[model samples]
Target: MMTYTREKNTQLLISLLKQHGVRYVVASPGNTNTAFIGSIQGDQYFTIFSAVDERSAAYMACGIAAETGETVVISCTGATASRNYLPGMTEAYYRKLPVIAVTSSQPIANIGHLSAQLLDRTVIPKDVAKLSVNLPIVKDNDDVWECEIKINQAILESCRHGGGPVHINLPTTFTKPFDVNKIQHARLINRVTIDDQFPLLEDKKVAIFIGSHKKMSKDVESLIDRFCEENNSVVFCDHTSAYKGKYRVHYSLVSGQEYNSIITERPDILIHFGEVTGDYYNLKIAAKEQVWRVSDDGEIRDSFRKLRYVFEMSLNSFFLNYVGHGTEINISYYETCKAKLDQVRNNIPEIPFSNIWAASQVSSKLPDHSVIHFGILNSLRSWNFFDIPDTVTSDSNVGGFGIDGNMSSLIGASLTNPEKLYFLVNGDLAFFYDLNVLGNRHVGANIRILLVNNGKGTEFRQYNHHANYFGEDTDKYIAAAGHFGNKSKSLVKCFVENLGFEYICASDKQEFLFQIDRFVTKNVQDRPMVFEIFTNSNDESCALEKMLSIDIDKKIVRKNKVKSVVGTSVISSVKKILGS
Candidate 1:
């Protein structure tokens, strides 16, 4: 039995959410959202988090959804508050996560003229949302049932349509205090199953590309791994896999020249999941083949220019039902490729004391079943290069989102799963971008942070623009006046300490190694810790560029040698010698 009243519409909203299995809400509170916040203040069924930055709040919801495979809601006030969600919403749209944005808008009458904290909110996120509904203001008790129905429909649509984000706009006057005792047996909808199947490949080469499957069940993950092993298929995975380390998944196969070569020699069938593949061009080539995409949500469209089949089912279920445990001729090919991959892995030069090395070292030490929330920009590349531990799950808004929501997302992740060892790896610039996140220090003791401070925009030196525009003077570029160039080491320590964090900074390799080892091994009081590693901006940039150049040269020489032996050496030999 359920109860409802006119004045407690906000409470009804919370009740309806619990009924529909919403476990988390990332919200930016304001006067407009007072009623909603009051209703859910002490509720046990949901965890409501407050983020100072609404954009980060939205991404935090997306991050939660990415980990839970459930719709996470984000709430903000009208006007610019709602607008701040664009970046995260765009990411959710592309990544196909179930994020619901619950926004409060101005009254309908004052929408057009200049009203405080008001703007054109009607069609702001039309392109991104799977469904956008403007809820009618609740003035009487009779509107409760209608509002509940619409909310249910929107949630159902978000989940059923393959897990994309949705939006629900509630005007400020919509909340009328309501009684929880009056509503009885409101409504419940049964799950609807969809038919999903794929034809077996009898004599075709097959490859599997797995993206960030952050929320996939362990059983499903094992099923996929077992199927791939039995079939002698090539497997590629990103940082999100919990079993990535065990299956010998190719972490580098998604990008670079190697990816291009793999795509050029197209396989007969390709099975893809998670968001975009690392390399766009390789994906383009793979899409030309008979691609079979398996996803629980039906949101995956054949936009990569390839599609033979779309299986709308859980990846684990599909693999268990259709794939057989068989090893055939492809075993030899798989072994040969594995050998090459091994060579590449073994030949990777050891990184010195720099951001890249630090990132790699931290990734190696990451605890099993831990969540790693990374900042955007350069830190992303470092993690992408290193072999992330299977137990260390990760989430980030890699696409351009204005705010560095990495820390906020970590907060939400920790709140959702307090038992797990959660860590956030961020650059100094990113840390300052959302430093206010620490203002709301609600996260428990398990949360940790690894802050990389290179003094300035260390990543910019790798780009040609810096080289061409600023010549070889990297420090000059670093010292340039702007947002990114600011170095606030003292400020960082002060802020973290103020937030009750056990803050420590290491300026060299030995100190960093010592601090990290001590931090991970020692049993300290349960509190969040921040280890800041100070590194040289120029050295970090140089290391990556040098590695890339060496790789390019090796490929050129190898290709030219092949051409020379085959009497096709005219242009190839010249290009190789000239390093073109």
Candidate 2:
């Protein structure tokens, strides 16, 4: 048996190139290339030729590939030796020749340590190479898989999709042996965007999920509905999902249910689309084995922690082609989900007066076809449980999930539609943090702010939150309770008055209800508006707990199994639907 390179990265490189069907490798002499060269010398599958100069070897590979219509490999060691191939690689790139450059180097960590023969090749001008990435030092299976994908990506760029030269910077530990025969097969990775054909999913149980999203176009919505009906799919929507169409499952109503029951019915293929969600139940999806992220920006949003495929495409295009190519099933994943969803809708409780509770009561009062933005943490989670009208769109800056930008983001969104009423609900911490933007001249009358001034971050008071472990210590630092002084005095009253706008300050539920209708409806003056409702941190936490869990028989309990009369009815219906 012929001995091949025992090194994983070197073996990976060789196997992937072979997998891509590269027969010619023009090599220049160097000590770093010993393992790769020695391994391939015995392998008659490759047509290896030696050239003294690196530049000559590159041109030779290009000439061979261009003439034979085959991908050719150019191998060189580190330092100025690889730099000499730049001119030839540039020529090959412009001519669209399939020339792959494998530049071997000593461990990258030795770069700034004054090590001899050090060379940095991270920067390859776009004109010279289509894509350039280094094979990082492999520590585990993930690293190996990443290297395999990167190598395959390089291979794809070199030989397919308008062929061009691609650079692979290989860093070596130098002691890897050239004595193992028959390297492990490399995994091939492919990129599918809106421009390309999609991967089929006939046998897979596909689950489409939407986070906080702006209202999608009718075309996108119709395609999603048709696709769900055609496949064994379920679209999971929280209040933030914004997809109020057929086959939608509101999981937040039952997220506090049994975890096993939730995962048992969960789809193996989870397709995550839209923006960042503030749904804690959404985190349960990380349990799946594979997650396919769908985004138009070609981003790597590995939120579920099991990202296998990234479809860089719009939501409309992805589903249209996804369902168009795959086999449609007569199976019903929706009917069962719908029955349980119906039960959850009935269990919507009357929460205590707090930030979320107040918002839940009034979120419906905001006129249809308006824009609403939520502050991060509590505010986002609060509104996520309630349904927004299909015509009305909402946004939450959960991307950064910071407190300061909530008001600013809502204000910025209002600028686009100054004619529509813009409502923003946030706590005192967020309200005070962004008070400066309230005085901006650009602030318009179309904005209606539902400021839930709870005076501190009550999120710390929830036992489910990590900060709650600190108990009273949390108030001292984490919650910043009473940080900006008690809400006894009007903080933004003078500010709003100065800006030529109406300001409503509600200290109790009666005052809030009395002023809320006007706050939602009376934005006629089109001046900047702010509504401050005073709430305590305790009330906010109590309402949040009650909102997350349902009540029955006048008894409040939070658990996987709810046994109250009404709870029993809901649980019984859910279990019957699940066939449990």
Candidate 3:
């Protein structure tokens, strides 16, 4: 009886290799890779070759793949063994051969600890591999998912884009005994190109989700609209998606709210495009069984953890292929989502004077042909709930999602079109961190900065945030309160005046409303402006709570809670106790 290795990563590698039909493997002998090489040495699914020299093994793979036109994998141990494979990889890179170098390594933590036979192989020469991924030893479920995706990516990259060489540096524990029989279940995500046959989505309930994208052109928007209408689907977007179509649904509005049982029909398949989405709450609620991502890079982006395929082609190609596929019956998913979103849009509660309140006041008041940039977290989340003018576009540094470069990115974008106005909604910590960019001489009069000076990192003080457990103690270190002169009224005014900026300050809603028109209506003739609004963390938290609990039926909520606790007989009693 042939048993696989007990090592999980080794098991996954062998299983996916068999699934991908990679039959030829040239392996060099070493103890670090014993668990992997030993498991597949006698397996009928693979034909393993032995080469004592790592360099000879790698070159042999190059020759075999070049002649057979098949993906060839070369395995070696840690230390200088992988170093010798670089020359062959560089040759394969130039010739465009389908060769995969699977180098087994010791734990990265062991490197710099005087451990023998351990080399720092974190990064290799760009010419050596088109893609290099480090596969960590699997110990938990997250590790398992990561390892599987990385291995699948490495295998797929070997034969993609006219074929090229790639590297997978696998770390091993070297102690698991060969005791398992069958490998664990792993998803084999196939890449679909324009030339290849796409999956039949004829009668399936489809939903297209777009992330943070640049202002889309008219052609792309028209294609998306036609595809949605013909396929009986809807397109979900956020403030940054830049997609203004008929079937567009700002899903963040309904997804962020608490009592969201009104819309329960999930899509059968989700087609994702664009980059990072700041609306993570909607993403969690929108997970489906099958997800097809479209990207020209051909990389596997398993964002929803249910990725079925990756369409490696232009966005236009994907929409063109599926536009004519129609469903027989009328699908109500789009209507359901729109009705739910409209419910919140029409019944928006009066929020406290915080970031959310500020966004509600300014989002609809922005001028046309302008651009707005938001800082991550509070600023991004607040603006996602409101609707801006269709003519106004928006963007954020959600790719990296850091607070450091929020304003710098806004300033950089202002230089692109000096005639158009550019607005930035930033938090106190972010504004102070990137204050140096405001002093840049290239800043134009079309730049407008709305500094929400809340005197702390209000994100940490949210009602449901983990940092709330510490209470006031959170401000000491986690929130870093009392920093930047504790929102000194004179500090920013003096600094911006020297930097040639007309400064404005507001402490209350009346003050903000009185001065907001001047900030919004100011054209290119005015000096660069900064409007700083002072708020508190309590109001911020309250505003967030109000926005999330907009349309809750107290009777139904209490009934469900009571049913889960006891029986339906006590539903009325629970509702009465809950004041409904």
Candidate 4:
């Protein structure tokens, strides 16, 4: 019997090709793609044609696809073989033909070494293929998931958005035997446009997750609000999501903890929108194959590794389709989430005076119509736990999620709306990296910066972080400690004051409380201010540990209550026996 190839990626490709309805394959003779070519040459599902020249084989595949309007796979070996497909691929690109060029090569590690038949095929001319993806030789589960998504993405791109040619660079070990009995059924992701029928989300535990988005229009907000009201749905947002609706819930407080009971009850379907999100902790509350991403880009972004459908449409149109449809109001899931959020919010412990505590103290007290931007990771995660006013808008440099451009972006936004207030909460590293922005002559008086200086990248020093294992040694290099004068008391004070700005330094709770109101309530006509609050890494780590473990502590308390009741029952029985 003819068995499948032992190579996992090759087996995956063969399975996907069969399932995606790719029947025509043009093969060129070579040793590098023997595992793939040998497995499919005898498969009854594929009509394989042999061509000695790779150049001719590519044009042949193109001709077959153009004639039948079906997807054609052109397979070739490593090095100069794939170079011959560019002309045909460019022709296919212009004509919008669905041709998938599968170029097999040796493991990428051999590329600059003295290995034969290995070429740098990682990059190619843009006009040749609409999408280019590289597939890893599968070794573990991560590799399997990566290979599956890449292959599915490449295959779908060929026929997506008016059809074009696509490239898949497959790295293979040349000596793998063809002895497997069956091929692994890889996951296939399907795309749905506005014209197609969307999946049924009625009465399901649905949740709409929005990342960093521009301020939504009232009409769009109303559409989403009605959708959640008609269907049992809630909007899970971080501070940057910019969604002011009735069903908004901050999932960050209950996330990233092991004992949060609500997290285990996964949503039936998660509808995702917008750009990058800094809330990596809250994105884990859905099962694989349960997410439906809605976007106009129509590209497959499997961020949670649970992408099952990509709805290609605008946000309003996507929601409007199901708002008045079969969806019924089921508030069980949303209420469950809100109750858990309230429990965590009401029982917040008296944490140390860290960045989190600072944000909690001032997040709700900011001016009603002001704008706020947080630094990436630690600063953003801190503010996400608290709620800002509906009229107060928030954003971050989370699109690139870098640490260097926080203040520069804030200064630029201040230039647009000179009358309104713009506040920035940034870590020391990010603030110092972009310190030159303060000296920009265009900076307005409406800007207020809260610089949390802990003398290091405190995120690396968190209790659960991998770098925390290094103890104080982590400060040597990993956290880049002692940089920029190591949180000098006079460093930032002098810098901001010299630039004709007001400087406020707070080293403890008492100092911060005294100066926070002055910084926030000051008129926009006043000089731009910088409030540099000094904190230590230990307090920052402790606050995050205490907040995330609240649900776990509740569980322990419940167990103790059960034990108390059992002890009372045992004591009553013993007393009754002694009296008798």
lDDT of 3 by residue, 1-580 (tens): 7877778888888888888889999999897888788888878888888999988988999899989999998999987999999889999999999899988988888889988999988878989998898887888989888988998998898998899999988888887667777877677788999889888886587888898887688888998878877777888888888898788887787777666553364688888888999987678555457889999887788888888889999888989997755645343777888887887888888888998999989998998888999999899999998888888889989998889998899989999999999999999999999999998999999999999999999999999799989999999999999999898999999999999999998998999999989889836756889999999999999999888888787876785686788986687777799999
TM-score of every candidate: 0.57, 0.78, 0.87, 0.91
lDDT (Cα, tens digit) per residue for candidate 4, span 5-37: 888899889988887888999998888888888
Compared with the true structure, what per-residue lDDT tens digits does model 2 show for residues 366-451?
Answer: 78888788888788777766666666777777877788788888888888877888888887888889888887888888888887
The deviation in Å at residue 169 for candidate 3 is 2.9
Clashes of each: 19, 3, 0, 0
Candidate 3 TM-score, true structure as reference: 0.87
TM-score of 2: 0.78
Candidate 4, residue 574: how far the Cα is off, in Å: 43
Winner on lDDT between 1 and 2 is: 2
Name the Cα RMSD for model 1. Answer: 19.1
Model 2: how far residue 181 lies from native, Å: 6.7
Q: 144-240, model 1: which lDDT tens digit per residue?
A: 6556555766676678657788888776664455345533333432232345334666666677766555576767767766665666566655554
Give the candidate number with the greatest TM-score: 4
